[model samples]
Target: MSVETDKIEIAFEQLVDIQNTIDTVLKVPKNPGHIGVRDMLRIIIGPQTDSDQEKLSEISSNFLARRQFKALLKSQTLASQTKQAAASSKTTSGQVRRSGDDFDLNLIPSTGDDKLFYMQLKVKNHERFAQISKAEMLFVESKGVFSSVPLPEILDGVSQIMIRQGHPVLDAFHDPEAEFFIK
Candidate 1:
């Protein structure tokens, strides 16, 4: 099944770009949760840093301090949102689950240059169905009419997944070779 997406979220896009950068320059630890920030300058800025801790300490503090501690403040807001999610999240059966993956629906544009992607959609009425539903081919929206694109084999010896804003994704982010992972 194919679904029309809501507007593409810019904040989410920015987050994705930031993650793409982090995953490019750092080393991925075998375990997860965090990247090894052995050299703060190298991790945050890049390898061409001055390699002087005292200077980097100032830069780091400035980055944290600018605009009234914006990074920390933004994190506080995010923390609160998750805190509230637990209470607001409820299903008819019991607790609500979050499947935060970005690719439930796959939207393809007419061509590669197209900015809009076709993907699965969430509708107003069908939010609470606890089952797996599959379709032979997916609905594609373009040219004022719907077309069809067969779903590609999702996992063909490729790293076929990433969790948005999740810790496990850190591994994928740091592996430069993972850049080619299928969306």
Candidate 2:
């Protein structure tokens, strides 16, 4: 076989060996179920390094924050578009195209006896709001709540929370504290 073919065969064998090891460690049944890459990595590495853990935490926090930001931006854009469409339609036809009362913000039921009902309903359906609240809490705890904190500040606070949670990556090259400058 050619050198490249030989190398590919060796790599394939190694992958099979790793899979067998994982199956053995996990005590897979006669018919093994699917195993994901993260599970395989955990089995191989045994335990993550502090640096690796920190990086993972930072990535997760950034992902959540960015997702929340994007959701907010999308909601605002849609609302603006809806408003513009309604206005244009009204100007053309001299009649309201949509009813303002169609949507109700108040969560009060007809009975109006339960005070916490609205809060519970909001929390149950709005998971993204909960995540944003947690992120905001981290920022407030780190640096007291500001009248208007910038987006970067919020992201920095999320990073700090990850560091405080015992995932400090102190390696020289990948040190979290090291500052990067662009020339």
TM-scores for all predictions: 0.16, 0.15
What are the clashing pairs of model 1?
A: 23-173, 23-174, 105-119, 105-120, 106-118, 107-118, 107-119
**How many steric overlaps are in each model, in order?**
7, 0
Reference-based lDDT, residue 119, model 2? 7
- For model 2, the superposed segments whose C-alpha errors exceed 4 Å read 28-183
What's the C-alpha lDDT at position 178 in model 2? 22
CA deviation > 4 Å runs, candidate 1: 1-133, 152-183
Per-residue lDDT for 1-183 in model 1, tens only?
123232346667888999999997795666422223343323222333343334333333443322232232232221111111222223454322222222222122223453433332221112321111221222211111211223333332111221233222222222222211111
Question: Candidate 1: what lDDT?
Answer: 0.28
Error in Å for residue 86 of model 2: 89
Top-lDDT candidate index = 1
Give all candidates' CA lDDT scores: 0.28, 0.27
